[model samples]
Target: MKITVTEDQAPLDYDQDQVAQQYQEAKQQLWRSRIEEPSLMRLIGDLRGKRVIDAACGEGYFTRRLRQAGAAEVVGFDISERMIELARSQEAHDPLGIAYRVEDARTVVPQQSFDLVVSAWLLVHAQTREELQEFCDGIASRLRPGGRFVTLTTNPDVYFFRPRPDYRKYGFEMTLAEHVKGGAPIRFTMHLEKADLEIVNYYLPLTEYQEAFRRAGFRDFQLHPLHLAPDPAGRDDRADWEDFLKNPIMILFDCVKAE
Candidate 1:
């Protein structure tokens, strides 16, 4: 029922059944272990009384987190059916009232729908600049005049294709065949349960994102580059955390719609 991705193949270049269990479990584990996840939470800020849409919400983790953080309303959606199924199932049992739907983030961007919109590592899927624009347009469309959209992304500066001591220290590797400015195929090798698996991503340049955000009517940007500064209160204490500071992994970006 599952197909595996070969070395010659793109990562996660498999059928839905694979993601149904194996890939998802690995991703979820990595989500907790990685430095980027906690950094994402810090970027999110206080959610009290805000209406949030968790675009590309995989497994509804953040959706429920948002609701628990006292968000006035929270809705989540994903393009993958299996991811949505897991999200909905979690919601049914936990009863967080977080709505989950199977829809691409670019579509169903209802006008003035939310006060804040967030996605976790969702921008890397835009393999083309045009697709990035459309995705930002959808995000902008869903926001009210003063709404903000935020997401975590791979640092465009780090050519993931090359080896990094930091990556190895963290127990995984990232590689790409070549560097393409606008978009390029990238892959993440995740080590889970002592086995290695790879997942595909796209290298989206910050410049491209700036242009897309501009076209989407976003007038301001706040990007938090990890590793430059230490958050005194941050709890993630991986052995390679210092190594992460040197090589840098990812960043969180926030863009605001003009009033």
Candidate 2:
């Protein structure tokens, strides 16, 4: 959907939503599990009987999951009208009691503060550190005092170190080994190699993120490397994956709003 923007504000185009949906559609994956399972499962497990907000919740796929996980109330907010429409359409059958709304991440005011807020892959494409801080401010604003915020983003170390290419390309041999991972064919084709596509990502260091959270009145924050080991002994060639888990392409932030 075309985002409405005034001269003073930047366009919060739902381009990310469209590209993500298109990629997922091409890959046939309903949601990204491998990347999401580690932190989300950890975050949701603590959310039973609590009010939860799924910020930047594209399509409400995981929003429905939050309801299933026993949240007292689940509200999924995204900036894309089409995404919200489609999410609602999918929930028309049983309606998992999750509400989906179209609202800008930077400006939308929550109906009420929530006990737990989770934003996934929303900060990866940020153009600068300030934008990431703005996102942090937004998350901080929607939390109840002493509430927790869980967000996932591209690993700054890995994102900054990835090789860059000057030309467009496609196709690569993926090994579940080394620092590189096989980009599984999902609704979209995300290559294992970084240089093939133009990625506008902010390499916001951990210290910078921590300071931003501090300024937002969040303390006692922890950064966990979002690395998952493949089923051990089940896959023989998984030793490389074990080592790769030391450093991953994603990072999860678990923080608490000061009381």
Total clashing pairs for each candidate: 1, 7
The TM-scores of all predictions, comma-separated, are 0.85, 0.72
lDDT of 1: 0.74
User: What is the Cα root-mean-square deviation between model 1 and the actual structure?
Assistant: 3.6
Candidate 1, pairs of clashing residues: 161-176
lDDT tens digits, residues 11-66, model 1? 45223655555556665654353455566667788988899999988777777878
* Number of the top-ranking candidate, with lDDT as the measure: 1
Model 2 TM-score?
A: 0.72
Q: Could you say which candidate leads in TM-score?
A: 1
* Runs off by more than 4 Å, candidate 2: 1-20, 26-31, 108-111, 159-199, 227-237, 240-244
Q: Mind giving the per-residue lDDT tens digits that candidate 2 earns over 35-130? A: 356556765465678999898887776688788878899989887787777678878976888888887677625544789988877775455567
lDDT for every model?
0.74, 0.62
